[model samples]
Target chain A: MTVVGYRRPAPGINPDNNSSAYASTRARAPRHPAIRIEHTLSEITGPHFETGGASAIDLTRGARGEALGERIIVTGRVLDDDGRAIAGALIETWQANAAGRYAHESDQHDAPLDPNFAGAGRIISDSDGAYRLVTIKPGAYPWRNHPNAWRPQHIHFSVFGTGFAARLITQMYFPGDPLLAIDPIFQSVADPDARARLVAALQMDVTVAEYALGYRFDIVLRGRDATPPQE
Target chain B: MKTKLTSSQTVGPFFAPLLRGDLSQMVSAETRGERVVIEGRVLDGNGDPVPDAMIEIWQANAEGRYDHPEDMQEKRLDPAFHGFGRVGTNARGEFTIHTIVPGAVPAQSAQSQAIWQAPHLNLIVFARGLLTRLVTRIYFPGEIANDSDPVLCAVPAGRRATLIAKDIERLAADKAASRRLCFDIVLQGANETVFFDV
Candidate 1:
């Protein structure tokens, strides 16, 4: 869904036109100490699990993920504290399998799916800041919105910051999801300009593995600045 | 586990972090009324801003007491009560709340105690991953009971006013009776909340 920062601006009742003095007055204030938290990946303790993963979008695995599907992998790189490539962050992803069904019991999708395909996977970045997961393209599904509200193709990803509070939670959306326009949640973003920030662009196209297409999405986690504080 | 990383191992690209939830989600398009906007900056002891922290304020209606049943104080309640709100700070750790000035709550102490605290608002701060939260009370000036209030005295003497708000005597020449209380909270860095811990 598209979301803008604080959409629907309130009635701004300021007599002071957006003047330079007002801006400077606001900028001079100093910082609070509580915000200075940082973490790296190895510090996170949650165990990673993929649900309904490894099944083919081809759905030949039947309603149960018992059969072997074509093997395709997703690779990504991590960034370091200095905005460089981080070599060892763990990237985990969970999603509905090829049949658009999750290992979660709450999911009521009645498509034939492989029991082995748990619809989830994880990959740790290599030395070059690269990581990859083996899975198939997920299918769009209908939600309760309308009698038939459908969601666009997307993947939920988690990156363990390697340490304490640095963990990141986000979703990767394929560039061209036609459902974006009608989605109420995505349309709720107050700032249309900022809403564009959430969409991911596809690269490394052409051929991933002949039958498998490739869409590369890179993510960055929160980290400390390399610059020392000024006196 | 490879704990030690040589300089060569530190190759990673930098991208500014993305906050998971959106603050815009907090604002609703439907609501009709005059909403007062209280805005201010949060600073550390060294006067630095804290980003991504949340500030909360809870106060009774203008009458001076909370609506909860536990409260048995004598303060008239104004039906126009809209004092509870939360604001998430931006990258600079600035915040604002819009509410009316609360009336003084008559001290529930016995006549012999005769203690009354100034009319004030309560504040709490919650930061990501912080196991403990920060709590402080904002006080208004000209409070006859400031001297006898137990919590105000709990704070060290030298910094009593840090917890108090600056009172505005008048807004304009012929304006109705109105007052603005300005309280700037100094967090622990080199500085700490005047009377708050955890």
Candidate 2:
């Protein structure tokens, strides 16, 4: 049997591996140009994740108590380039606590870590390609990339779409974050429009009345051709 | 009409605690094929360990058939093999996987002719500094088919060695030893691993 491969990402949508502003990339970006190859069954087939495991969708509470911060609801749909819903996709998320400190041992930020907040969550997209997460607004934190460099408040996301080629690891920034202007990681994408797609928008309709604010962040993965290969 | 794709970001240092399961073991006692052990480290250009990196691998079953609908070939699918594994590098930047040597699979050229790909594992790397995930493949050394593999041939002759894993004797010396191999990844600078854009 023959398979039709997924489309390559549009130019200027992906970040350059050699972006100089991100100090770590200087030592990690490959110098050789990536070899473009035809996709095969290896690229079209990926592992399907089941929701029966210990996956959690809420990040607002822990075994001890509720996390402290402004409660918010984050929800969105996972779609392909043609805007078709991609159901059963796995979405994993992690972030710093409200005090701008991570629960990781490597985090050197002097802020306080919330004992009640592990700041991690995972969920599978529903049949409609929609997912929702309940969590607190993360605070901005400073990194050593540059003097006085503070990343905008954002949640890191790892998404596994339908195929191996559709895997994505990205950050979802909050709207109106002043740090977006100077954040090198956010600016790495050359296209202004493409960069803006990383920021989630405010949506009152998704907000839980008197409970939590709502934000919408839609994601688009690589799409396959409309036609399948002939036998 | 085309919609803009969402931009990528680093996987960050905090993801280790969130990866819920032990995906390092991809085989069971009932699984078929030659048992093999793949071990490696994730390193930076300066040769420092990247402990925060996560690696995911996908490959065919021992019969060279993927457990997906698209792989409609007539090969047998081992019920014990799911052809997937996910793990994070340790504090010392090391990782390991236990699986079998998959059989060669059939591919096609632009003209619909059959082409054979050598036994290999597809890998994806995600780390704290990489805004985008890196895609690569691991091919076993000494496979005669390596000479004609289309993907390997596409790479320049000088750098093809980066994609091949080295046979390590230390791992083979273990009690339950399988075929032990090592393949370290250099994210940049000299001897950087070959990354594919596909």
Q: Which 10-residue span in candidate 2 chain B carries the lowest summed lDDT?
A: B168-177
| Candidate 2 lDDT, A1-231, residue by residue in tens | 466888887778899888889887887777878899888888888988885433327888788989999889999998888888888888888899998988988899999989999888888888878899999999999999999999999998888887898899899999999999999999988889988899999999988798999999998998886555533
Clashes of each: 58, 1
Error of 1 at B141 (Å): 34
How does model 2 fare in lDDT?
0.87
Tens-digit lDDT track for model 1 on B112-196?
6445446666665544322123556777667776777666766668667777666544557725433444556665433445534
Identify the leading candidate in terms of lDDT.
2
Per-residue accuracy of model 1 over A1-231 as CA lDDT, tens digit each: 010111111222111111222222232222332221111111111122232332222222335444344444444556644455655565656666666655554467786556666655555566666665556666677666456777665566656443223344445556678977765334433345333434555445523646555556556543442321221
Chain A TM-score (model 2) = 0.95
Span of 10 residues, lowest total lDDT, candidate 1 chain A: A1-10
| Per-residue lDDT value at A113 in model 2 | 85
* Model 2 per-residue lDDT tens digits across residues B58-176: 99988899887778889898889989899899989999988899888876566667788999999999887887889999999899999999899999999999999999875434747
